[model samples]
Target: MRILLTGGGTGGHTIPIVAVVQELRRQRKDLKLFWLGDDHPEERAAKENNIPFQKIACGKFRRYFSFWNLIDFFKIPAGIFQSFFLILGFKPHVVFSKGGYVSLPVIIAAWLLRKKIIVHESDAVPGLANRIAARLASKVLLGFNAHSAETLSAKSLRGKYIFTGNPVRREILKGDPVKAREFFHLSKEKPAILVMGGSQGARFINDLISRSLSKLSEYQIIHSTGVNNVSVIARSDCRERQSNLISTENHYRFCSYLDVAKMALAYVACDLVISRAGANTLAEIAARGLPSILIPLPSAASDHQFANAKIFEKRGASIVVEQKDLTSRKLVSLITSLLKNPNQLETMSKKAKNTITKGKYFLIKKLRISIFKIN
Candidate 1:
């Protein structure tokens, strides 16, 4: 079987497709895979999976007025032309699209080429790209619940939309706590905290951690400060100890990025997760039954991250704090209060694992064999 995976512009779009590609490779040895995406960020991730990749122009459609949007209007047709030829040459049997600004043209080109298309929407609400792609897709997968996916389209298209949660890297499930203790040199006396802020524009969370790290000395902290903001860690007395990963000031550590293995260990080692409400990361955390404090990106497209976080909050899986209300003092207080109640944490974990939509891979496998498969 030949499969062309399409999505980009952020790790949220790219990572889920990578997880699906990993499952595809594991299920079949004869499959041919190609990735068509935008931007340089995920090219390394694609190559790491040994899949050939092609970059295409992406024209974002904004809800508000922008002069750049007028200029970007032309890139859509150009991208379609590029994607058309690529899809023709690849002649993929199925097109797997994780929706983002980069994917709309790819979806149109694949539809024109008459390829079977399956799309997954990771946000609680569908953005313009997925809202458009859902109409063209033969099967629409939802990272949230059925009601969430149902609202993405009209009642007529409901048959195509299926709730499959979100795809998580299989390696994320295989963490060893003993290895994590030895490697990170974590103290057993203090509770561990994992802080994440997605791949881009993490300065807000970075600053919060900087202000609050000293106040939360009772806990060990590991902060993933996005690649561009790692320098935020080397302040005051702490200097650069290593390359990507740095150990600083008693019980604190920081890293620019976390590959699958490192992320797995971080999940198990930490008693609590503090993160932005990206659906991909939330899926991984939910899979492990980790309770979290989610600070959603208020400015995200359609304000979908906040919407995603609210679902977790409503389910008793996480505490949602608005960006405007977030501060060092409130953060420290929340962390202290939550960590003090072990029973509440356990209840949160149970709700996280039990309440959210899950087991996406099984349905994904069924799609590959049934609706998506072509001889």
Candidate 2:
């Protein structure tokens, strides 16, 4: 079976698609996977995973008027033609989109070609690209509660909606806590907190954490500082400055990025997570049953990250800290309070365990049977 997967722009969109692609390959070794996206990190990720990767014309879609929007307007037509010829030559049986601006043209081309199209929305609300694609999709898969009335009212949507919580890498659910503790050189006496700013990193979060380093001395820290900020963190000497505050030697570790194996270990080793509120991150946190404090990116398109964080906060699975309101002192206070209350942590963990469904299998089955017609 030939399947074309498309999405790009950020790790938030690309990572979940990678998880789906991994599951697809596992289920059907004979399947042929092709990925098309604008030149972006996700394209490289797809290539690394052995999927045939293609770069296509794509334009960013914005809600408000901007000078770049005019340039993107022309790119849209170019993208459509680019996608048309590519889809025609590749002859895919189905197209699965993880909904990004890059996926818009691909889905439109697939719709014109009369190929089965399936789309997944990672956030609580559909983005512009997904809203447009939903009309043409054979099935619209949701990453949150399928029964939510908000989703039921998605524009141009028909009767083809299914609730299949965002696809999470199953490997993330298993990790050796002891090995993780050793790997990070963490102390058994202190609670370990995992801090991240998504795959690419968040400068603001890094700075906040750096400023709070002294107050966080009581806890072991495993921080993923994003590749771009690694040098900045090192040059600033946050690690050296904070060393005096830590009770044990080398109580803090900073990683530019965490590969799948390391991420699994970090999840298992950490007592709590402090990170951005991207859907993919939340999905992974939910899968691992980890309690988190989310600082939603205030500028995220349509305030989707804030909305995503709210979902978890409402469920008692996580605490939401708006980026605009976040401060080093506040963060440290929240972290210290949560870490000190094991009973509260246990309750939050149990709530987290029940917050989301781990049913990537349901989505995969639909892709195989309904989209691929492999039944």
Candidate 3:
């Protein structure tokens, strides 16, 4: 009947929580929903979704030493206090934490208040935050298979784990190719490739794509360059350069960010996707049965992006191109080769779709059972 959701830091942590919120609302319109997190993209997402949101002070835990670590040490207690007061007042029936530093304080508070807590991890390896949250959580849901989390096996968490393939936004799977083609003013003449750099966008991928525009002339392009990098790539000089390099028959569309509507359309319109291998992004791509070339961020926490990409590659869902080894020429060649073979693309798409868990409705059922048992 009532739910408290928390997660932040990156879209990967926040987006899945949003998907869960959406599903919960669809199933029960009268449900009272509240979000607790830091002042980040999740705040904006909560506002857009009309979920009542309250901010809590949170701190990051870094592996290496930093001057900020000294300051962050104090913030942890402050965050716990903030969470305690907030959770005590809200007193929700259940708290679902999509793992992030922000979720730790919230989960600890929920446990202290004797509320049910469910935590989800989106990586092959659990982060420090999730590992801590798991101790207090009644259930630990995983994006990958349970065996992939070798680090978790040695922990004291005995009965709190289940493998739930990453939750994807249902809206993503509802795009119409005809509507998408018209919406983007794209011709059906050439195969379209969608390039996504996550919510904040990846500078490395953006730069490589900019330089490789000429090489992608055979395909129509739909590029989401993140909100921050859109203007930089949209400047007159950049546009002029892209125009000269791109063939007249090919189309290039650039967007700073894609909302739910545009995102679904882009997914449907594109024949292939080139993206950073964030778990949330891969989940959406897999749900749509799209073949992709994934460029893992070398700097991702715990090198999780590389791990995620490798799994997809092993499953025949995607091609992994490490950022360290990636070049404009290399990316161009891979794209062209993949696109040239329709059968391979189709096979990859089928595998990608198969990777997603069948019967998503079961998650909703499981959540309801958990919540009712708690109530």
Candidate 4:
């Protein structure tokens, strides 16, 4: 069996597709898989995973009219033509899309070729691509339960909308705490806090962390500062400054990225996580039962990250800090308070685990059967 997977422009879209591909490969070693993504980091991730990849040029239709909009408009036809030839030669039995601007043309091409289509929408409000693809796909999968069957068009409802909780990489599902600590040289005695800014890193969060590093030293810290901000952060000497303030011990570590296995370890070793509320991150955090301080990217499409964070906050699994209200003092206070209150942390962790456990496995198995048609 052959399958074509397409989605990109960010790790949020790419990572989940990679997760599904990982599962598909595990189940069917003979199956052939190809990834179609923009000439971006997502394609690099696919290559790192040893998946065959093809880069396509695509653009989004803007909500507002601009000169670039016309150029982007033209790219659509070019993208569709490019996708048509790729699909014609590849002849995938099915095309699975994690909706994004990059997936729009591939999905349209798949529809034209009468290829069986499966799409996963990872947001509370579906993206424009998935919203359109819903009309053409045989199945539309949702990551959340906010949208109802009746809300979809008749065609989409007939095709079936299944809530297949987001697919998380297998390594993340099971990380080794001891190994993670040893690999990162983390102290087992100190509370560990994992701070991240998604794939690109968040400048606001980075700045806050830089200011709060001294206070945060009471707890061991692992911060993924994102590639762009690494030099700035490293040169700023947040680690050195913290060591100076709190006895010269290795209580902090920073990196631009972490591979899946290392990331799994970080998750396993973490007592609390501070991160942007991306769907993929939320799934990973829940999978590991880590309590969180979620600061949603205010600019995320459809304000989806805020919604994602609220879902966890509602269950007392996380605390949501809007960007506008986020400050170094507030963050330090929250972390210090959460860490000191072990019972509160345990309660939040249990609740977080419960909320995610409610549907994760069933949804994963259901998606597997629906896409691969395996009983």
Candidate 5:
């Protein structure tokens, strides 16, 4: 069987698609998988996984009118034409799209070619691209129930809508805590906090962490400062003041990025995670049963990050700290409190695990059955 998957522009959209592709490959070794994405980190991720990739030039339709929108409109036709030829050659039995601006043209082209199309919307409020794709797709998958199916029109509700928890990397499904700690040279004696700001990193989070580096030393730190922000963080004067608190040698480790395997290790090695509440990030955290403090990006499309964070918070799996209220002092205090009280951490962790375990595998399996029609 052949499948073409498309999504990009951010790790949020790209990583989940990768997770699904990995699951499909494991289930059917004979599956021919092709990725259609723009030239972005998603493409790099696909390459790292050894998936065959074809680039399609595509652009988003901005909410506001501009000259660039005109340019984008022109690109859409070109992208569709290019996708048409690619789909003809590949002849995929199905096209799975993790909704993103880059996936728009490929989805449209796939529909026109009569390929069975499936779309997964990661947020409660579907992005513009997914809203458009929903009309043409045979199935529309949702990450959460709160999203209005009516927004996609009545046709989506009759036979297509399915609630699949966001797909997460396979490695995160299990991890060896002792091995993970040893790999990162973390002392099992101290609580570990994993800090990640997504692929590109969050400037606001980085700044707050930098200022509170000294306070963070009370706990072991595994900070993925993002590749672009590494130098800025490494060179910041905060290190000079905080060097004594955290071992200049091992108290804190800063990484530019994490592959699927490393990311799994980090998830297992840490006692707590502080991160932006992107759908994929939250899904992985939930799958691992880790307690986290989520700071949703205020600017996320349609304020979806806040909505996503609330879902976890409501389940008692995580604590949501709004970006506007986030400060170095507040973050430091929250981490310190969580670390000092093992009972609270344990309770939160168990809740997260229980909530996620209830449906994690079922969701993935359901999506697989829907896309491949596997019995």
Candidate 6:
């Protein structure tokens, strides 16, 4: 079957698509895959997986009043025009959308051709793009089960709903801690804490880490500070080392972003995760059964990240810290407290593993059976 994957804007959208595609390839080698997006992560995922990628015009809507929204409105029509012909040429059997602003045009074009479209919503509260695409979807696959009507808020969205938990790349689950230590050159004396602001990197989190890194010299910190923020962190890291505030050379390891392999290694190497509460990242963390301190993005649309973090907190798998409440000192204290409480850590780890709502079925198998009608 020919599958055209459409999603982008951030790692949250692109990574899950990669995970789903990875599973599909394992199950069926003959399946032809194509990706459509105009972003580095999307293009890289396609190239890394050897799927053909084509860039397309993409536009987004703002919830709040914005001058950019007026400008973006025009791009949608242009995007639709471009997407229609792209879909016409590819002749895909299905369009799997991971629900990003970039995907609305593709979903519409696929709908125009009478092609089946499947949408996966990775947030507890759906984004506007997904909310619009959900109207046209044949199957609306949810990353989290929708308990409240807020997730599927529109009355007109009549698609079949399936709660197939967010897909985590299989390679992410196959990490080796021994190799991680070697690869990261981590000291065996201290436990490692993985700090990430999600795929794009968070300046907010980076600032917090920068202020706290010297004080956080008690544990190894492996930070993914976003690609754009690397130099900023690098300069700070140098100053900290030069000032001898950080006792060891290997105390802090940082990068702009981590590819799949490096991310897997980081997951296994770290004892705890300090990250943004994006559902895709949370899915991987839960799959790995790692205890975490979740700092939700304060300005997230619909306050979704806060909701996502609360779900983990309710499960005892994570502690939700609103960005407003988070401080460098608070982060250090939380890490210290968790390290001191091994029993709590163990329980949280167990909860994280069983956090999967649809635990019985493999995500790809579910997709095959649901979409392909495979018995």
Q: Quick one: best lDDT, which candidate?
A: 1
Which digits, one per residue and each the tens of the lDDT, describe model 4 over residues 1-375? 999989888888988887887777777877888888797777787888888998887988777778898888888888899999999999999999998899999999999999999988877667778778888888888887654244455743674687777777878877578888877788889899998999788877877887888887789988877756543445455434432212124787776666777788889988999999888898888878889999999988768788888988998999999999988899999999999999999999988886555544555666777798611
For model 3, residues 124-184, the per-residue Cα lDDT tens digits are 7677898888888888787887544565774578767777778777787787898898878
Measured on C-alpha atoms, candidate 3 has an lDDT of: 0.81
Across 229-301, the per-residue lDDT of candidate 2 in tens digits comes to: 5434444544344322222235667766777778888899999999998888988887778899999888888
| Model 1 residue-pair collision total | 0
Candidate whose TM-score is highest: 1
Alpha-carbon deviation at 369 in model 6, angstroms: 3.0
**Model 1: per-residue Cα lDDT over 161-218, one tens digit each:** 7666777778888877778866678987788999989866377888899889889988
Question: How displaced is residue 155 in candidate 5, in Å?
Answer: 4.7
Query: Comparing candidate 3 with candidate 6, which one achieves the higher TM-score?
Result: 3
List candidate 6 segments past 4 Å from native.
147-150, 153-159, 231-233, 236-250, 357-361
- Candidate 6 residue lDDT tens string, 117-196: 98888888888888888889888887777642356867676447887778888888877888898888887768899988
Candidate 4 regions with alpha-carbon error over 4 angstroms: 63-65, 148-159, 235-249, 358-362
What lDDT does the true structure give each of the candidates? 0.83, 0.80, 0.81, 0.81, 0.81, 0.81
TM-score for each prediction?
A: 0.93, 0.91, 0.92, 0.91, 0.91, 0.91
Alpha carbon RMSD to native, model 4: 3.7
Evaluate model 2: give its TM-score. 0.91
Which segments of model 2 are wrong by more than 4 Å? Answer: 146-156, 229-232, 235-249, 358-375
TM-score, prediction 1 = 0.93
Answer with 1 or 2, whichever has the higher lDDT: 1
Deviation from native of the Cα of residue 343 in model 3, angstroms: 0.5
